[model samples]
Target: MDTHTAATRYIGPTGMDPIFNRIANWLPKLGIDVAGGRLLAVRGRKSGEWRTTLVNVLTTDDGNRYLVAPRGHTQWVRNLRVAGAGEIRLGRKVEAFTATEVADADKIPVLRAYLDRWGWEVGRFFEGVTQDATDAELADIAPGFPVFRLA
Candidate 1:
């Protein structure tokens, strides 16, 4: 996650990515759980229609749950800000909840935990930070990663 890599790696999903997400969204609907992945259905800010995407759920050590957007300023993030609440669906099971945006200063531990769990998938976005990274190091890159405290 060098500066150059971090600077360039987070281009957001493009090209075939949406197609892949559409397919991934199906597995959860089909009753197949993929690494705690779920279909996150949130109301679109402008369209007022449900926008669905695949997201991996993170359960912290304190029994709290979270959703981290490694890609900064993404559509889902923007929609969540307006909608305030959303649903996470896994097959027939769905959990409806509210989301609180975690402040950048408070995201170090959450970001660290996220990297520990899914860094292999999202590490590129962190600018080279890792789970073993120092608190100062993680804090330096925290703002780029948006975290939601779910309840």
Candidate 2:
């Protein structure tokens, strides 16, 4: 199997850090995801619980907000699928939004932008790995990666 596929297979589905709660609490106060982005708080699909995560606020040329899941098929992605739709808190305002799973073909550029924004860590992670993951490969791993927008 290709490196990207292999990595996804190995990671499988895992739980998130407890600290995510702390980050979620502070994100709104700090006005995260507001001007153009916001924090999405969703319920776990199987676990049926709350999970809040910080994600980049991506605005397409047409004026829609999207949250890209670069980590592939992580817990957040699964939770988003289960929750279907959730809430976004921006500054003092909170709004409900629907989560949609975008296909790889349509999401590659956005994924590339996300990796670029997180270059330092992403670069370091792939530093020693012989099988460097291409943007397309990364997208393929979790094809159903979630993208959230205002509902």
- Which number leads on TM-score? 1
lDDT of every model, 2 decimals:
0.84, 0.58
lDDT tens per residue, model 1, 1-151: 3544433333577778779877888998887987778889899999999998888889999999999988876789889989999999988998999999998789999988888999997777676779999999987776667789999
**Candidate 2's residue-wise lDDT over 1-151, tens digit each?**
3555633532332355356546655766587643344566788787777777665666656776677654545677678777788777667777778867665567666555545555443333333221245755755543534445544
TM-score of 2: 0.62
Best by lDDT: 1
Tell how far residue 3 is off in model 1, in angstroms: 15
Candidate 1: 10-residue stretch with minimal lDDT: 1-10
User: Candidate 2, after superposition: displacement of residue 131 in Å?
Assistant: 18
lDDT of 2 at 31: 79
- What's the count of clashing pairs in each model shown? 2, 3
Q: What local lDDT score does residue 54 receive in model 1, on the 0 to 100 scale?
A: 85
